[model samples]
Target: MEIDYASHFSALAHPQRLSVLRMLLRRYPDAVPAGEVAQALNVKSNTLSAYLAALRAAGFVTQERDGTSLRYAASPAGLSALFDGFLRECCQGRPDLCRGIGGDLQTKKGTDMPFRVLFLCTGNSARSIFAECLLRAIGGDRFEVHSAGTRPASQLNPLAVRMLAEKGHETDGLRAKHMSEYQNDAKAGFDFVFTVCDRAANEECPAWPGQPISGHWSTPDPVAVHGTEAERMLAFQTAYGMLQNRISAFVSLPLETLDNLALQHAVDDIARKD
Candidate 1:
């Protein structure tokens, strides 16, 4: 069947619309909920609905009936069709023009190189940091863990730090950082990247290289909780517990035994599992 390349290009004309597509592609093979996409893009439900509809109409995105809610993901064929068409008709078989389209997606991990992993949250002060520490403690020699925020707070949250200390984790290396510190993974990206909060889940992630598998393990924002000191700490405790459970299961996975698609589904299922 002939694909309408013009319609697909036109649909991505709007910047936000284009962003939605890119973000979805980053989470390819794993669809995101419509509301989560809106939250990530900071768009009103109606506005995002229009953007998604255009993408959907152009066959650039796909919509699935996930229970009662709608989920969106980049269509597997949409961009590929565009590229094949561009090379055949526009670039006239210039393979160099297609170099930027795909990348080496293999995991080149070895005994000498630890399997790199990254965790993300918006503020970086709490959840992502918590995850970095947890994975570091649990993953041992097989993993090298990192965490960052989309919009990092100036310092690590005192409460988050205190709680970790109470649990006996060293606090010296826990600094708030932006994701860009690990940017341009086009040559070598993390083996896995998980967004632990809803905000970060929606936020546009870095262009991961080498087929980094991604998952959304949405934990409640401890900082967003506005309550008494004790109650607030409880939020941190709960978030920490949830993340601990998920990360334990994650590090326990037989990663070496699973292929990329299986690993993708495994990590994605980690979200729903806990």
Candidate 2:
């Protein structure tokens, strides 16, 4: 089959269009509602429709009708074709370079070293806890993830723990701790420090030892939501989904290639989407 790499590249040229593709990739094999995608990207419905249409035309994403609204997911075949075509063109007649292409691509640059990440919030019970757990579940081998709060909770939130358990995430070693613990410890440092709530982002934080790149991913406090048992559970689930989406985007980044300034911009861009 003939492939038009130019069209595919053109389709992905727009930043918003690329973001839509990444969002779909995160939920690959599972279609997400168009409205949800738009909400996550903070794009106008009309604008997002246009972006999706471009992706569909390029064969990067597939859309299916689920009752009234459309659902979208990444097309594995299209992605494979795009990548394979690039490699074939770039590595032609270079057997040695092509031999370890797959292995080298996955572990390229600084991926060998464990990246330490810290999630911070006003209270470590909910948002930060969920971020810590989700990142560990997704990128534990590559990242040493931790969470802390300015004012630590006495214990982990039961709802948070239950959500993690339901999602098949480990909760055995998880507990609330004060940010001061990491701050005062000379050896404690992080590659990235993320503030998951507005309160924490506004508050003055300790000067991290390594001067790690920092960004704010503001999420509503699920614990603060007052509602019925079902409603409360729903709140927790919503928060979990938000963090999962953000972390999925985080894990997908080509961290080894992006410098600190570029990495900081990328982190800030991810937060702006939500």
Candidate 3:
């Protein structure tokens, strides 16, 4: 269904509406009840009801009567329109520019030439590990991704391993690796080196042979939390959720248009969640 773009955006302009949309995005294809969404976000039922009504009227959500209540789910066409609009506007009218940054959302077959990416952090534990597993799972066959730490850890953080498993990704072969493992190694230099730690981002990095484009994510260390096991796990989940969100945006980038600096700037803008 064709939707009024203005109405759709207007409905999303409010903070609550956007938050609700994000909550739905996190549960795509799963129709969540109005009460459940309200409770999860701590919004008053009536206030959230109004937001949902606006969203439904704007075609951002679809509502179905499920027994005693209604369930709201994402309208893919609506979301595509919204994000596609974003891609066009922010990318300066060039959708292909997304490929230059690292997007491999769903690479075409026979076009699986692997791009090299290195995920870095201070301890090679949580954030970097999440990036590696996430990229491998979602980056199509277009990437050969590795995660390493500026200061290597003797073992992988167990929480990171557990979280990855919970996310339906295999953690069998994952281990904490040293940044030195690939730095200056003729065979494995990266095409993109993303530092997930403040320390790693500021520190002098090993000279990448290809002079990989670099960026900093600066995620807080989840393993450093002094808390009960449940609290620490919650912290890890929070970090994982944040990383997952950023990675989804990063993977939407167009890596093929870097030769055009104008397009590169636009891609960069979209890649940074800040």
Query: lDDT by residue for model 3 over 1-274, one digit each (tens)?
Result: 3445667789889998978876664344457788888877789999999999998887789999999999997675676677666666666767465443343222322465677888999889889999898888888677899999988889988878987898899888888888878876776356677777555654545467764655556567898887899999988988887777777777776665443343334434443553
Model 1 residue 42 CA deviation (Å) reads 5.5
Q: How would the candidate models be sorted by TM-score, starting from the highest?
A: 1, 2, 3
Q: Please, what is the TM-score per model?
A: 0.74, 0.60, 0.57
lDDT of 3: 0.73
Residue pairs with colliding backbones in model 2 are none
Tens-digit lDDT track of model 1 for 223-244: 9899799999999999999999
Question: Which candidate gets the maximum lDDT versus the true structure?
Answer: 1
Q: lDDT value for candidate 1?
A: 0.82
Off by more than 4 A, model 2: 1-111
What local distance difference test score does each model get? 0.82, 0.79, 0.73
Measured by TM-score, the strongest candidate is 1
User: What is the C-alpha lDDT profile of model 2 across 1-274, one tens digit per residue?
Assistant: 6778888899999999998887665444446788888877788999999999999998899999999889997785787677677667855736655442222222336546678899999789988999998999898688888899988889988988988899898889889999987886565467788888755654545578866767677677899988798899999998888889999999998887776656766786687665
Alpha-carbon error at 5 in model 1, in Å?
6.9
lDDT of 3 at 56: 81
User: What is the Cα root-mean-square deviation between model 2 and the actual structure?
Assistant: 10.9
Query: What lDDT score is found at residue 130 in candidate 3?
Result: 93
